[model samples]
Target: MTEEIEAQSFEEEDVEFFEFKQFNKNALSVQLDTDTVYPEVIPPYPSLLAISNTYGYFVAATNEGFIYASTQDLHELFDNSEAGSKELLSQKIHFEISEGKVRCLRLSSDQLTLIVVVEGGLVLFYDVTKFASEKAGCQPFQIMTFPDDIRDLRPNPGEKYNLIAILLVSGIVYIKDYLLNNEISKIEGSKVGERFTAMCWSQKGKQIICGNHLGQLMQYTPEGTHKSSIQPPQELQQHYVQNVLWLESALFVVAYFPVIQEDDSELDVFIISRETKSKTLYIKSPTICSQISSDHPKLPYLYMETIKDWGPNLKCLIICASANSADINLIARDESNNWTSLNLSDTTRAALPLSEVNDEDTLPVGLALDFTCMESWITRLTADENTEVPPVPILYILNNECDIVAYRCFHKDAFFVDESFSGMSPPQKLPVTGHSSGMTLPKRDLSHSTTSTQNTTVLSAPIKTESPITDPIETGSPIVAPIKTASPVFAPIKTASPVVAPIKTASPVVAPIKTASPIIAPIKTASPMIVPTKSGISNNSLSSSISYDKNISSQKKIRTPPPDSTPSRNLGSNQPTEADSKTPHMIRMNATNNEINELHNLIEELENSYIAKYHDRTTEQCFDNPDAWLIGDLPVITSEINRLEHEASSMSQALADLRRQVNEFSHDVHIDYVKTTKDIEHLMYTPSTITVGRRGILQSRIKERLETTFKVGCYINFQRLFVYTNLYLCL
Candidate 1:
């Protein structure tokens, strides 16, 4: 993949370079720890891993039960080009259990104890520092075996003692001291038979909380005393809690349940506040993509890639799993203060040239399990102030091929950018709405109508305009329509060769309407305007009239009046004067012109209303298309129905085969029971016939030990009688 990246030709859409890259090639590799002894057979790959933010170290437990540790230089990895060139400094830690695979690995925040759990119920606790030292040797400091498999382990958040909490598969949780082999307490789960699947320590470490298979949450003190129990809401009664985390003042739980459909699944996230228990936020699976787990062989699990509070205090929860593309779901709050799930698929798609294989399969497989980010914040203010782009935390992704790629989120919206950090320049804060300004203005939807003119050839010669006369609309009243003017006659420009004829100057359009205070600028066109000069001058005056005002000459005018229309309004009144109405004999000179003015006003209102409606429909379509298609889940529903039908057929066949096997086993057990009874009956009769057992035993002993004198004398009488009888029979 790395070779392909370097050689592949990218189209315009593909991003050739990324802001993020892996700091070290050996950061997650077992090969970096050369001193560690591997098993004779092929070693198991890492099933669980974790990285320490403070110490820049990582501990990973492979399936073969080998624990590999590495001391990483985060700066070197995150900086620039030097990251991949350097090898990671590492050490290998060994333990007594060499058989079963590792199940879970967790490290304390203080880096004191490394908790290790393997398959087969074995739990090993190690001192963080000594375990990494060569002199301390390879054995765990303390070990315990549970009756059932260990599901999850969490270190006590309490600063007082170095304690760890382990959840067993048998609905029990144990809080114990890591240093001293002492069991502080054992707390039974809420239900008798249900297992505790998820557990976490309180923010202050004063309490331990665990979620059970029955969807019940229980809190316990360090000494195994029950503090409180929380039953899930009625809607979530059937769902099981898969993961629980104590993030700040909230208990975040990821719960899932199988639907009635053969393979369909649903997931819900419940965030319950510690301060106010009633304050709860429930989120269903987001509709960013289709159901990712619908066709998966295994159900979806929330694998925490990393949790960061970057860019001031923007809490970022990065989750990477098969359910959400390998890019991870960047779950964060949107601008509206609503929890929004942003998929990194689009971000990664733009940054990397992924294969054309099925994205669902290609995304989650063989990617790096551990991801970390810098402590720095890139706040909104900082982003706005910096002439250069704000330094965002780079996301490093490692694939199975060992090729690493990096990506950074693009700041495309003000709300999308982190708002935590302050700006370099002291921000001149603007007053929020409804704060300093108590006065409010109503919002109105305003639309503008643009009139386009027909294209025509340019005369190539500049025309002059006479001094413009200023006329203001009457005060205290609104003007309904623009005053009409006569059209200008075109005078041909003499040229050597005319490539194209001059364009026809269209009628002018009305100026846009303004609110409250209105200033109207007259519409001017490419052709000159002819003002009536007291004389009955030919329409030639229209071409010769030039404006003296420089502003009037420079303004590109829109023709407002319809062609061949007579002048309507007078200079001083709302209505056109009688003299302007007199026209050619064929025109209706007798009709009252007031009706014409009313009709024109009505037509203008109708045009404005049509334009407003057009804009509203366009806006509605933009928002409606996605909601109807995406939220409807049509594509996902179709695919799920097909997949479920196939799964149903397979499960039915398997169930039938299982039933047949059970019947056969039952028949064999019945035959064995009858045979045993007959043997017992025969043995009872044989016992009654064994009255000469002592005599028979004596004869057998004399024959067996005849070679020994003591033994032969002891049985001489019995042996002589047998010998005499044998001799008489022979004679």
Candidate 2:
């Protein structure tokens, strides 16, 4: 390895490049009408799906499987309304279920009907408000069919909640939710008979799974009871179960994959057992290199992806939500790795001080689920905004040479970013914490599935292809939510490794990169190798590093910045000129590193975009230094700033070893204040007694004795005053 290139190299010293990049609010492109708003949305594809913001109108699914109902976040809520303000409506639905593109879309949490699952088969259902809000597409008011041709769809559990389940494609799986004979229900009967390729709904929903192809899973319960049957142990399900997830009740993780391939198809990860019929083991099947799934529920951290023995084939993605789900934030691509957030909770088996374990408080083994997909799985998980904690999870990962990342799994406590910056500072809008502790995520003893065998896991929808992203990494395993409490909760699926083939119905259809984009960035280095500060720099600044390797190797002096906009994207009149914007940035810098990893597959092309939406406080943009890694999911704050810089460097080295093991020192940590001198000769000889309230002292007990002797004004993390001074409460 005679290579130290340490003599010095970073040089792009032409700093004068700024004119239009100035509109930075972090990122906001907008622009939509993909044909009068979302007219069945289908402009391009390979994977970039999601829509259904529950009720205030919104719904979607497209890639040629067609379905749309909007109010904007559904991908077409335009506003030009003649200029006088408001307008976001988008509707297009006459119910077209030929099933070839659409991979997943569900909206039952009562916003009324809308489900579309086509990878090649079908499951279409739509209503978009049945008739008028001003009509958008309204048709098929209800059309159903599924014994096995679907491929992943979901909706079960609280909040306006409704009901939905399907994942067939010959892997046979179904759940329907209601309305049997006349439509909607498909008459139950399929339970474990085998054929499910992915399913999920075990956050305690009393049985709703299917994983088949023979590797098995097959649970059922809408009251027709069939609950029981799990496999994967005849040498890893022999192949099948593309994705399924659920993380905090126990285990039922599956990413499986082995139906046949030769050089790099090996993925694996399974932990199943929502009560009984077991399976366990994780993290050794070639040490997972990419993963994601925690679409936020407050930091349930999971993300890791790597590959770079030397260069060019580079590959990056790292973040497994650190800062106390214990150790995870390890990205690399030659940038080395580390950004630790270690403490894997188990407060003797976590009971919510909101515990998260794998190490902290030791006590291992709970909510277990062994995994396998030969290489990696789990590609999206998010939740965060103190909905109490479990919902701030963000994970999206994949790597062999492809990248898609987005990460951040909770870690704030400077009393939760100073009481959430004192109720969001200034004026006052407050109201954020509504408590969803979400089964506090870190508990797993495993045993579920026996309220007459009710286990669950489904992943459906598997049509992928939007590659062009950056950071995030590996599986954490715990998902168990439909929980009204029978315990059994294991469902995992965050996929990648698609090949499928066969589809050319003549070409010309394109849309699928609408939003959720960030392909993981804030790039990782969670371990060791990072070198490039351009190595060191000198030979007379190597002529400014050969003018930044000749401004990133001149395509005529690296200058193609225009076109952040001008409204010129024709795609076909055969328009894409300027030599098609210098060919995907020169085929994204000379392709191959597996097609320059499809220019960073941010889970199939920048799902809605991001640099940091971050949310809550309103505006705090900065980003530090990002050039690429944009595809949605990337916020495991360098293992939570390496767990608050290792607890502020172990609290400044335990206050400098407690002032060098002092012989005389006190431990009070003071901050007291009690001012009040209202004249009248100081209130007639200081006799001020105003205690007509609850016995005597209470203004939250003198602001907890002057904010615990003055540590007031700033705090949002000693676990939010551990119940106001360790649980004695105001007194």
Candidate 3:
């Protein structure tokens, strides 16, 4: 109970309950190497495995590399307009860098670089607009150092190359150039026990890819050579690859694997595709299993992107985390381009934040109802479209203790609502676009355009829908940008057109690719079955299009047809259709039958208010409220009713000392049965009184057959009945 009201407010100020302990002893005297002697602690709340934002700053980094950052303006601390600050999101220390622990932070997508890395192999980098315009702290004017530690670093998909890549821990690979401070190419691993774990870049940063642990995937060249490998997926062998992404004709990846033949481990994903070089799976999770039965089932955070105004060609999305729930799964992509996933944590529970919306001062840390890592970026300001504000999309979650929140994400393709066209009128202001189609706009303001109280602009658009796919330059097309390819270029394999068709019998291509076209779309043929991975996964009745096809180096073979030879969405209408009967498939079934008739009149007004206010209460007039108890629940119910009335007066003096030891054991068993019947009537002639000492009558016929065979074998060895009556009188 809040530690008994904080030990009764530290015993009403007599104070003596101060044991706070999180001593990193000044981060172990700023440790450099020396293996450590003792004092190190620091987990008073640590685990935040990587997060990185931009556009009015955001940086979390923890697992002990500590980091923090956020001096306001994250869209005014995620749209509440900082509500008179006191900690909507204050956090400070951009870096208390006591040597290696952080592992990864990575911001740069022109938010002007961040990086970090750590785990004893260094790397650092920072310059995030000169550490938020010199409010300084996480000092790293570029470092680097590696003797083998750093595991994954990436960067270099386009900004004309200040390059990065890295990977290390003895499986080697470098690319470096942390803006020309050296090493522009190293690579390694053509075999001799290849290790490599995961890489990205692709064919514009001039190629790279990687993956290895064992579930192979390779390919490289930013001057390091190697190239073609793949193979992966006999259900991803022993697994390992953990995240890859270059999704522009596909590489994606993910991996981790684990299911040692099923005691529940799984984490899959796959894709591959440089135009059907074929790999596919895409998203897996089924046996999630881990609510701490000795915790194991790995794999969380995935994140994807490829957007294009939530519609026509180039959709992707992805956004992961939810092995089972504090929510976060989004996924998207399907008018046959496939992908799905959903849960976007219930459209972010109507935007969440004031530290989970007014729980009355609770979060100092301790938030694992879901989301242990999430990062979605893209900030673009540019307002004055009559003072606009409706783009939404922010994200940044991270919970299992590292705390960090910041929501605003809402997606039904940017605010969808048409439950039967409610229109009681008024509600139509919709121009929302923070980087829509080729992204690149982060110079702060991040336009949440005034107005605050946070649902950051509620459903914002579809009042009666005069075509609102949420503006990628208002649909007819002017917002272009997408193809920043380093490897998702795909469309060249038409072996005679058919990669599993049936999107209402295929037809719509309409040619839409040129706003700086590097050839974007073309992968659309859906229905190869396997969709159902749960959590919402919507489609609203598939009809989407745009598949571009700029001849992506053809490598055909995608045929899969026999699911009863296709053809059906009522193959040419079996009747019905007048715009699908005035578009109201029961409008959420009459708002779920008026919420099931107000839950049957709210269960008969809560059963007549429990029969007119707590029915005939019994149990001492229903616990005769001494001010309704709970000041420590009435001192634990008056010390358990004085410990059950001193255990019923010591169980009534132990039932009078067990009835005086059962009346002295029944008066010593009736005086030892009357002194053994007067000592067997004073041993009066029992057992033929005349002792057969001389064994008369030939030992009395062997002592009467040895006393009738020792009384019929209920044998007592009185020296074996006197040696069986002297062996039956020495027969």
Q: Weakest 10 consecutive residues, lDDT, candidate 1?
A: 1-10
Ranking by lDDT: 1, 3, 2
Tens digit per residue, CA lDDT, model 1, 588-647: 422323444455478679768766755554555543355554432443445657999999
In candidate 3, residue 109 scores what lDDT?
49
TM-score of each: 0.44, 0.21, 0.22
Rate residue 707 of model 2 by lDDT: 58
Superior by lDDT: candidate 1 or candidate 2: 1
RMSD of 2: 33.9
Q: What would the TM-score be for candidate 3 when compared with the true structure?
A: 0.22
lDDT of 2 by residue, 142-226 (tens): 2343323344567665442445665445553444432221112322335433455666666656666666666666666654366
The sequence of per-residue lDDT tens digits that candidate 3 reaches over residues 93-179 is 445566646656665445366777666455666555444344544355445555456666767766645677877756677786664
Off by over 4 Å in 3: 1-56, 59-88, 91-108, 112-157, 160-199, 202-204, 208-214, 220-227, 230-240, 243-256, 259-399, 404-731
Give candidate 2's error at residue 619 in angstroms.
59
Best candidate, lDDT-wise?
Answer: 1
Query: Candidate 1's error at 49, in angstroms?
Result: 1.0
In terms of TM-score, how similar is model 1 to the real structure?
0.44
Instruction: Give the winner by lDDT: 2 or 3.
Output: 3
Query: For each candidate, what is the lDDT?
Result: 0.43, 0.33, 0.42
